[model samples]
Target: MTVEYRPIVPKIKRFKILVIKIVFIVLGRAFQSASQHDEEIKREISSWRDGFTLIMKVMPDGPYMGLEKKNNMLEFKGSKLKQADLEIYFRNVESAFMIMTPQMGSHQAFAEKRMSIKGDLGIATAFTRALVIVMSVLYPEFIVKRLVKRVPPLTIKRAGLRVWLYTLGIVLGR
Candidate 1:
């Protein structure tokens, strides 16, 4: 009897790539929209290496999102860049989703060994803080509280600004 053998790894890789692309698209929109209206976000993004790329990936050769900060703007491209200043790797797709969905905070994911980061510590920390700020602008207060290690106090003005930024983000198809 003859039997057919098929590898599932390729299919899994494709799925992971699709998920990562979708996530990055949403994140890219959020960053671009927030930067336009929030000086703090613009400043934070500008601190990075000009044209520097940050890639977030699911490890074991999974999918990745390549993000570049240039001209004080954050943009996401479909494919991985040749080089990245920072690479944040999740052990697997589930691990990536756990943190991305706000079910587990990023700090908790790192503490639990679900993530591996390669880059300068200082730059990574600053980038993380910038992500937190971006999250605050993208998501609701309760969601942000769950996703971040520490939720900063939000003033009325800042909250109102977030609302406007979010509206702009949606309008811009972010």
Candidate 2:
């Protein structure tokens, strides 16, 4: 009797990429909404110079999404530009998927080396704060508390902002 063996091959799932793309769309849209309605986000972005761009993508051939501050507002860039002032890369689709699912926060992802940042450290810190603020408002209090170190109190404004996000901001892809 003769036995033949083949090699085990790893495949990147299309569904995973699709899900990530969808999540990026929603998250990008949410950022735009947050800039408009959330004071914290406005404060953070307002400090950035006009035309500043931030890009987030999976490494080694993956989908990308971006945002740019233009005219004191953030607009989705749809990954058209090849470069950005700040670039965040998830090591792989799996890593991107994990973060997109928000299994852990971006801070943990960076610590684990699953994510890398290319840009000014100070701006990155400010962006982190803005991200925390966005996550606090975008997710429910229970979920937000579990995901991040500090969950800002769910004030009436944040609650209303959340409602607007779900209803118009995210839904309409603003």
Candidate 3:
């Protein structure tokens, strides 16, 4: 008798999951290490706060305010910020992230509800916009690219489709 080798999708999935787990662990550790050196980030951000006011709906447990400057001063709530010479807002991190992400155009999610803002809308918009810009610069794109490159051969399209299907299934209780 002889045995035949077989390719199994389940095995492939398990392997993919393992790979993703390893990637996340490595990235998480890297972040933890980098955070220990955050004084540099603090200095960089402090230099940017030359002329700006920022209000944040800080998580009860989070550091309450962030003032940063790039080409101009910016105030960040969570990561939300205003960019004009003088800008302010009372916003939370969720709102900031939502406004800055591509979701701003239409898919505005949870930000408005989760955060409260009482200030100049124009300046607030500037703050969020500037925060987006500074964050883009501060976040290491190279790490992101490398992490993405490590993803299983599954393309983003496939991943997105899988997520959509999974979501649908959960919603439909299938």
Candidate 4:
């Protein structure tokens, strides 16, 4: 007796579903880890004990959010904090993450008005310096191209350059 083999469409469907589930789980874990990292940074900053409220209103729109770390507890508006004393402002979500990264200064996004820095100008400067320290300590971007390559895709690299040129022109009183 000969046994007949059947084509397995159902099996293929099941395999696709399994793959989708696995992908979702992996991505979810990555996002959670990133958020936890943000939280850890916030906690570390709070340790500084500034005792001043940093109200960061995401501009060109009225998000109206604030970061206040009076004591050990770090509180934010809407209870949507995964981090501490640092308040991020960006034109969009992608730019926000990019600015958070080290070697970020080369990117046009930071130089442009797209990402604005508000509150505690001294602390903001300190934060960037501290980031440099942390980056140097943890993972140094010694390789030039490797660091520059990580810059996010801005709509126009020329935009930042133009702003720089215009600023220089004004300073020179042209």
Largest TM-score belongs to which candidate?
2
Best by lDDT: 2
Better of 1 and 3 by TM-score: 1
Model 3 residue 90 CA deviation in Å: 7.9
lDDT per residue for candidate 2 within 1-174, as digits (tens), equals 898899989887899999889988888888887788788878888879999999889898899999999877688877786789999899999999998887778888889999999998788888888888878877777777776888877789989988899899876645
Q: All candidates' TM-scores? A: 0.78, 0.91, 0.30, 0.35
Tell me the TM-score of model 3.
0.30
Model 4, residue 165: distance off in Å is 40
TM-score of 4: 0.35
Cα lDDT, all candidates: 0.72, 0.85, 0.35, 0.39
lDDT-better candidate, 1 vs 2: 2
Candidate 1 residues lying further than 4 Å off, grouped into runs, are 1-20, 80-82, 155-161, 164-174
Cα deviation of 128, candidate 2, in Å: 1.2
Worst lDDT run of 10 residues, candidate 3, spans 101-110
How close is each model in CA RMSD to the real structure? 3.4, 2.1, 19.5, 17.9
**Is 2 or 4 the stronger prediction by TM-score?**
2
Candidate 3 segments whose C-alpha is farther than 4 A from its true place: 1-52, 59-62, 66-112, 140-174
lDDT over C-alpha atoms for residue 60 of model 3: 34
Per-residue accuracy of model 3 over 67-103 as CA lDDT, tens digit each: 3332332222233433333423324444434433322
- TM-score rank order: 2, 1, 4, 3
